[model samples]
Target chain A: MQMTKQEYSKLVDKKSPPSKKLKNCIFAFLIGGAICTLGQLLMLLYEKAGLSETQVKMAVPVTLIFLACVATGFKVFDSIALIAGAGTLVPITGFANAVLSPAIEFKSEGHVMGIGAKMFSIAGPVLVFGLTAGVVYGLVLSIFRLF
Target chain B: MPQRTGHTLMLPSKPSVTGYAAVVGKKEGEGPLAQWFDKINEDTTVGESSWEKAESALVRDALALALDKSNNPPSAIDYLFAGDLLNQCTGTAFGLRDYNIPYVGMYGACSTMALTLAQAAIYVDSGAAQKCAAATSSHFCSAERQFRQPLEYGGQRPPTSQWTVTGAGAAIVENAGPGPYISAVTLGKMVDYGIKDANNMGAAMAPAAADTIKTYFEDTNTSPNDYDLILTGDLARIGSDLLYELLGRENINIRDKHNDCGLMIFDLKKQKVNAGASGCGCAATVLCSYVFEQLRQRSLRNILFCATGALMSTTTSQQGESIPSVAHLLNITI
Candidate 1:
């Protein structure tokens, strides 16, 4: 009826299925690479259209995120995510899903509290720190440019 | 420790399930068992501002339908045994607050339905109450937010992950109603089989289900084949397979009539649910809607409903703690 934590752990470990680490790793690698390649293709297409470097940089992410949102709306992205695992999480689309899904799910809750508030739930921290880093880089660059 | 036989509790008087109701969200409504459920809310929000409120409304809608179907006024109910996959069972307390009946909130995670029914049966059999209500609810959004990642996170679910059934089920048991009766109940003991993967709940809970069902068969001296149907809650595919193998080793072949609410609640082939449907409502909805309909009509008999639960908190799982799971079995017969 009673046992040490170690004993209990042993009991649980004895019954659990063995992990397929090699298979999981291979899938994560392949999928992660694919998602990144898709993002790169958007950038390449923007470059071919003779867009300015700044416009291309902005347009690429916007297209990738929009595609991710569309795939999520169609319920196809989650299917890809099922197999890709870390590959999905590592890509920008994964972040897009994080921002879009909750907002969409809680859409009925109203804009202020639902979309406005929850849209930033998972990706908020990333946005905050990322923007802050960008601002810091811009400020340092501007100061050097002036010098 | 006299080998702990006779753990089974036979009723003093036959307890009958007089009324029941099941409700779910649109996703579950799209499942194969859609037609069987009493009601399905088209939107996950249920016209509520927050996920918690939506869950409370699910319990409210389900209990209202159950009480209405039973043809009993709210005042006729003696006590309400209710719970949900929420902290302190807040969903239960909040959902049923409008009702003046005495309430007893319980928590067995996903196993709340069977646990409540078993207790409600015992109370009725003991003449503690002429009519008692047993209810439980779970919302996908609420449970996901509480137990795992917020749906807003849109986290990638593992193949082992199960979709939580966003619904509520309510049933009223009485002494002098209908033919199908609660004959016996076998409460399970907490068993930790050291499964640490929070994503793979079926694996974590399979051993506990095996242990409970095995002990139930041993104590009652009943064979699996003797029952027309045996159902386990929320084990889905993986856990159900393990259960089959566990029982098979003992020469108990239940493949002919065995069902998992998880697998039954959703059409895994068509639905994206990798493992199957889960949550407290998983068993509650399937059993209350489909199973109860069958039993009430005398289409089938000798049903063993065992609801399984994975008892772990966010903190515990985050701390790398192994899951402790349990199952409660209620033998229903006509």
Candidate 2:
């Protein structure tokens, strides 16, 4: 009557439903493409507004982050991501949500220990690795320039 | 007289459930069992500023309602067994602190309802207490941040993952009542099948549930057909299937008589609850509402209520430890 963990896991896998990865991927691609296209459209709109290249470069992400924050506050981003999957995740909007989410969740604990400390809980790993990779790339480029 | 039959405790006194109440949040209020709940809070916060406090309020409201229905004062209750999914069982501690009742905080994760109920019945059956109350709650918002993710975090839950029911249930058990009595009880041992994936809790807890149910049947010399129902707490779709498979191996076919509180609470097609609803509240609220109602109506005369719990903390899981689970069974008869 007793089964090993491996056997039990197999049984569990057999009984449990499999994830629809193909369907998820298709949804992710469509929604991700749509999000990127929206970003491109925003860039074009900013250009039409006669903003400088630098200003437009900063404005695009700022606008997206602002929208993400607002959507997160209204609890709409999670619903969107439920269908969009990684579509909304692999963008700047996802990062905004990651940061703002804990900020909102932990705010009950108080400003100091709650929101301030846990604000980056989800996005903290990304920041650490991203900054480390940037530094490593800069170091490699600087050493190559010396040659 | 309390007679011990292997792992089952035969309660000859048959401590009866006198009062019961279920309180749930907005999401659960929209579920199929909405009408069954005594009170449904449209606000997830339950008018509280924090989710932890709100969860406490759920437990308090449920216990208060149950006591109110039983016409029992707080001083009349000798023991109160309550617990929740929060760390250190803060929800129960805070919720019942002001009630001035002798409180016993319990921790069995999702199986808390059955654990509390069985203990309450034991206390009453053994003549240690004339009256006892069992209560438990689980808040989705509180559990999400503590166990899974932040409320606003944008991520997809796996198909096997179950949603925590934001609700609470309470019942008052006494030596004398109008029936629907606790006739027997079986407390399960920890069973681990090395399920490391926290998302697939049904797989982790199913082994324990199977072990407990099989043991109960063996101890009592009974079969699935002997009872009107075999109700499991919060096993949902995947765990229930696994339970069937595991029990099938032992020639114990409960598929015909079985129903999980998780599956009964929510409509999976519309609720987006993946496999089904989970948490301590899943079983607690269902038992306190639907099952008790059915018992009262004589629709379900005899039943076995088994609540399953996964005993793995976040730290243990993060340290690569497999989940060990338990299931406590209570045989109730009207």
Best by lDDT: 2
Report residue A77 deviation for candidate 1 (angstroms).
5.4
The sequence of per-residue lDDT tens digits that candidate 2 reaches over residues B54-127 is: 99999999999999999999999999999999999998998889999999999999999999999999999999
Candidate 1 pairs with clashing backbones: A12-B193, A12-B194
Candidate 1 lDDT over A1-147, as tens digits, reads 223446535544454445456776788899888877887897888899999999998998888889889988777776777677677777788898888877776676688997798778778888999999999999999999997
Docking class of 1: acceptable
Worst 10 residues of 2 chain B by lDDT: B148-157
Q: What DockQ do the predictions score, one after another?
A: 0.24, 0.76
Strongest candidate by TM-score = 2
> Which regions of candidate 2 deviate over 4 angstroms?
none
lDDT of 1 at B31: 88
DockQ of prediction 2: 0.76
The positional error of residue A47 in candidate 1, measured at the CA in angstroms, is: 5.5
Model 1, residue A131: displacement in angstroms? 13
